[model samples]
Target: MHNAINESYLGERYSEWSLDSDSTIETPNKNQAPWGLENISPIFRAYENSIWQNHVAAMWSHLEARYNITSNDSCGTHVHISLIEGYSLSALKRICQSIIYFEPAFEAILPRARLGNEYARSNWLDNPNFGYKRLSRRESMVVIEKCTSVRELVLLTPTTISSLGGISSISLKPLKEPLNFVVVQQARLSAMSLYKISKIPATVGGLKWFIEAAQLPQQPGLFDTRYINLLLDSVGPKLTREPKPMGKLSPDKLRKLQTKKDEDKRKNVMLAKISQPPYWG
Candidate 1:
C-alpha cells in the first residue's frame, strides 16, 4: 500500500527506499528538516495501518491538487523521504484512539463559549483569569441564590466560586417543578484543582465555583449521587428524617412519563429532520 501511494504521488522523485533501524537523515545544511523527516522510522508501517494510510493518502492528494504539482520528476535530484523507526502497533492504535476520544470532547467544550447564555458568554471572554476575577466570594453566593434554573446555575458556577478544598456544608430542599430536589452544597477548594482535577464539578457546578467550594466527594463519580453521599456521610447524621423506602412509581405514572418522553423524542426528531436547502427555481 505504501509503495502504491509512493508510486502514484512520488513517482521518479521517490528515490530508492532505504529501510533502517534508528537512523536520522540530515539536510544539506546539516540542520534538521522542519517535518522531522529524519525521524521516519520503519516501525511506522504498523503506525500507518490502513486507516492512517488512507488519511495520509488523502492529505497527499489534497496537497498535490492544490499546488498543481505532478508525480513526475519536476526536479532532477531524488527527494529524500524519512520515516521514523521503533513504535509498536499498540502504541499507534492508542494514538488513534486518543484522537477519536479527544475530538468529541474538544467539539463539546470548544463551542460552549459560543452559547447564547450571558454567563457562558462572559465566562468565555479572553481574560487572563478566564472571567473568575470578576466576582468575590460573597458575590458568587449571591449569584448562585439568584439563579432560577439549572442551566443558569451551571453557567454561574464557574464564575462564582474559586475551588472545592473540602466539604463545608450540604443542604437539600424539595423542589416543585422539573426536578424533585435542589441540593446546595458549599466547599473550600482551589481554582486550579477544580478546573483541572475534577470533571464532575467542572461540568455540573462550574469550574470556578468547584475550586472555591470546600465541600466535595473524595471518591470520583457523578455529581448528584456523589454529592448526596458526601452529605450523608458528613452531614446526614445530623438530619432528622427517618429513611423512607425508596419510592416506587405506580404503573400509570410510569406509563404517562414514558409517553411524555416518547413525544419529546418525536418532536426532536422532526425538528432535526427539517432542513433548508437553496432552491435556484
Candidate 2:
C-alpha cells in the first residue's frame, strides 16, 4: 500500500528521518482498533482536538521523515469532541445546523468524493435526527445512552462522531458554565476542512497496510515541521481545555521560578555538551 502511492502526486519528503509514532487516540471506548496482528493494518491513526495539537505536530515530524500525506476519501479526519454532561442532542444538532449552514466554506476544501463515501455519506447526513427540532437534555441522553460505537453516530449526520472514551474524554464541562458545543464543533469542522489536503504524487518500493490510503491523492508534506507547527499554533487552544492559571506567586515563588529556569539551562547545556553531532546533516 505504501509503495503504490505516487510520489509525483503526493509531493517530496524534505527533512531528516526516523520512525517514531507519537499519534494518540485518547478517546476512550472507541472500538478497540483491531489489536491482534490479524486485524492489525499498518496505518497511522490519530484523534486529537486543539488541546493536543502539538502531539499531532510532533507525530508529523516522524511521518514527514517517511511518507507524504494523502488526504482522500479513505484518509479523512473524524473529529471526536467530548461533550459536557447533562448535554442535550439539541446542542449537537445546533452544531449540525451550523455545518449545514456554512457548507460552502467547508465544501471548497474537502475532496468532492469524500462527502459521499461510506464513512461520510452525504445522503445519510440528510437524516431528520440532526434537524432543527431540539431534543431535550433528557431526550437526547436517552438516545445517546442506548448506543455505542462510531457507526451508531450515523444518526447525527454532519456531526459524525457520536461519543468516545477518556477522562479528558470522560470529564464533562462544568454544568453552570455556558458552553456552545456548536461553536466548538464548528471550529473543529473548519479545522478538519483546512487540513483535508487532497492530493500528492509519490513513489516508494514496498507497500503494507491501510490499502485505502493508496486510493487517492497523497500528502507529501503532511509532516513538514513548519506546517505542523503552524497547524498546532493555529488551533491547539480550541481543542484542549485551558489550564487554570496558578495564581500570582509570592516573592518566594518568583524566586523558585527563576531557580527552575536556571536549572533547566544548566541541564540543557550539559546535555548538549554530551550530545553527538547531527547524523543527517
Candidate 3:
C-alpha cells in the first residue's frame, strides 16, 4: 500500500520522515470499507486547493483505474482542515463557537447513518444517557469567549481515546470531562505558544452566507428531517445543567502556563553543557 501510494506522488511519505505512525495513512474499519477485497487507505499531507486537485485527486484516480475501488454506506471520508498557518486566539474561539452554534443546521444535510454516529458525535447535543450537558449558542460562546490561549481553545473540542492496539484501525472512544482530565493535562503540557497572526475574516455573515454558497435555497421550515431531533434526542439537553468552563485556570494562571519548549529550556541548556567535554582549566 505504501509503495503504491508513494508511486503516485513526488514528495516523501510522512512515514518516511516521521516516527509517529499515527500521522500516516490508516486502514479503515473492516466493517465499513469495501468487502471481499483488502482495503488500503493512503492519507496525504495537507495541500492547497490546486495541489489537492493535481496530486491528491490524481492519486485517487490512479487507484480507481488500477483497482476496482468502491464505496458503500459504511464508508465515509474525513476531511481535516489544516492549521499550517494556525489561527488567532479570537479566530479559533469563533470557529469553535460557530461549529457548536451551527451544528444542527450542518447535521441537517448529512446522510441518515451520520446523524448520531458514535464515531463522530454531536458536540452541541448533550445526551444525558451518555452523560453530558448541551450548550446553548450564548452558553457555548461564553465558553469559547473566555479562552485566553490555544490550549484552552483546543480543549473545547471532543476528547477521544485511541482504539486498542494500533493507528491503522479507525476506532476511538469519546471521553467527557473529569474522565478526560489526563488528556487535558497532557495537552496543556504540550501547548503551543500563542502568537498573533493576520486578521481573521469576519464570521458575522454567519450561516446565511454559508447556505447561499452551498446553493441551498431558503425554505419556510427546517429541513424535513426534524424527526432526527426527536429520534436522537439531539434537539438540546433536556435536563438542565451548567456549562462548564473548558479550563479551570484563571486568566492570571493561564498566562503563567508556558509553552513546552520554554518550560524545558533550562534543563535543555544544562544537558547541552553536560554533554560537552569539561574545560581543560
Candidate 1 minimal-lDDT segment of 10 residues: 162-171
lDDT of 1 by residue, 160-199 (tens): 2211100111111211111101122212211222123334
Candidate 2 shows a clash count of: 27
- Winner of 2 and 3 under TM-score: 3
Q: How many backbone clashes does candidate 1 have?
A: 29
Score each candidate by Cα lDDT: 0.26, 0.29, 0.34
For model 2, residues 10-120, the per-residue Cα lDDT tens digits are 222222222221112122334453211100112222222222334345545655587543332233243333332523544443333333333322333334444322233
Model 1: lDDT to the true structure: 0.26
Q: Candidate 2 at 187: error in angstroms?
A: 6.1
**Clash count (model 3, backbone only):** 0
The TM-score values for the models, in the order shown, are 0.16, 0.30, 0.44
* Candidates ranked, most accurate by TM-score first: 3, 2, 1
Q: What tens-digit string does per-residue lDDT give for candidate 3 at 138-168?
A: 5655765676887766655433111110111
lDDT of model number 2: 0.29
Q: Candidate 3: list runs displaced more than 4 Å.
A: 1-12, 15-49, 126-131, 159-208, 211-281
Cα miss at 251, model 1 (Å)? 59
